[model samples]
Target: MECVFCHIVRGEAAAHLVYEDRAVVAFLDARPLFEGHVLVVPREHLPTLTDLPPQLLGPYYAVVRRLAGAVQTAMGAEGSFVAANNRVSQSVPHFHTHVVPRRRKDGLRGFFWPRGRYPDAARAAEVARRVREVVSADGAG
Candidate 1:
C-alpha cells in the first residue's frame, strides 16, 4: 500500500520507537508539536480506527493508555493529550493515535499551531532524556 507508517512498521525508515508488539508499533513524531509527542499505530495500516478489526480494538486502547503514561512521565508535563483523526485531519492517511505531553504554558491553547523553535539544543535534550527514561521503564514489562 505504500503507507509511510507501514514502512515504519516494517523498519524501512528510521523512527524513534517507543513500543511494539505483534500487531502494533509506537514511535515519536518527526515534526513534533510538543517534544515528547508520539504516535501509536497498528502494523496493519488501517485508514482509521473504525477500519481496524474488532480483535485489534482492545489492544489499541491499551497501547494508547500505556503510551500516554509514558509520555507524561518522560516529558515532565503537567498533563497529556491523546487524539485520533478520522478524515481531513488525518495527515498520514493511516490509523494512528497521537500521545502529546501538555505543559501549563506551552501557548498551545488548541491543537492547531505555527510555533517557534526550541531556541537551543538543551531544551530538545531535556525532552529526549525524559521520554527515553519513561518509555524505557514502562516498556520493561
Candidate 2:
C-alpha cells in the first residue's frame, strides 16, 4: 500500500520534521492532537511492532523517551502520552510511535482525539533538530 507516513519517511511528503537518523525519522503530525505532538517512526517502515526485532525495540522506545523530554521542555507540556495504534487505530498503515505533549487541560479526552493546527515550518524544524540531537546523543551514550 502507498502509505502517507512512508512518503513522509521518504521525504516525498513535506513534514515538519523534528528528528531523523539512519534508523528513525520523527516529525510533527500535520493534524496533531497537541501543539508538540510528534511521531517517531522507523526508517525501514515496519507495519507493526510485532514486525520489529526485539533488539530494535529499545532503541526505538529510547528515541521516544528522549523526544518526550524534549517535548516537555520545549513546549512546557505538563504531561504526555505515547502510543502506537496497530490493529485498532493505525492511520498510516506503518509502524510509528506517537509522542504527544500534553497539558492539564488540552482537551485530549480519553483517546477521543481532536485535530490541532500545524506550527510554522521554521519553528518546527528548529524544534525537530533539537529533539533529534537529544535523542541521538542519548542513543550514542
Candidate 3:
C-alpha cells in the first residue's frame, strides 16, 4: 500500500504545507490536537525513525527544530510539543515528527495518557543501567 505521507511528499495528495525543502516537508495536520499542529516528514519513504539513514538525521532534525520555533511564533504559542512515535502509536508508518503549539492553561495534560512513577529508586536505577548498557554496546553512550 502507498503511504499517505509519501503521496503528500510527492504532491499526489493535498496538504496545507507550512514548509518544504529538498530534505523535509512540513504540513498542517488534518485533525489537529490544537489549531497550529504541524507534521514534518522526510521527502523519502522511510517507514520509521530507525529506518532513517544516519546521513539524513542531522538535516531532518534541523528542519524539525526550526518548525518547532516557527509553529510557536506563528501561532503565538508560549511553547511547543515536538515528538514522533516510532511504530507502536504511529498512525502513519512514515517517520514524521509532530510540532504542536502550546500555551498555558491549554487544558491538555502532561501527556495524552496516564502517567505513573517507578516502583522504587532501585527499579529506576536498574532500568537506567540496562538502557545505558545497550547504548554503550551500540557505541552511542
Candidate topping lDDT: 3
Under the 3 Å rule for N, CA and C atoms, how many clashes does model 1 have? 0
Q: How close is candidate 1 to the true structure, as a TM-score?
A: 0.76
The residue-by-residue lDDT of candidate 1 on 20-126, one tens digit each, is 99998999999988899999999997998779988999998899999999999999998898999997789998999999999888877876767688879999999
Regions of candidate 2 where Cα sits further than 4 Å from its true position: 110-141
Regions more than 4 Å wrong, model 3: none
For model 2, state the Cα shift of residue 82 in Å.
Answer: 0.8
List where candidate 1 sits over 4 angstroms from the true fold: 111-141
Residue 88 displacement (Å), model 2: 1.3
Q: What is the TM-score of each candidate against the true structure?
A: 0.76, 0.74, 0.95
Clashing pairs in 2: 18-128
Over 106-136, each residue of candidate 3 has an lDDT whose tens digit, in order, gives 9988788999999999999999999999999
lDDT of 1 at 23: 90
Of 1 and 3, the candidate ahead on TM-score is 3
Backbone collision count in every prediction?
Answer: 0, 1, 0
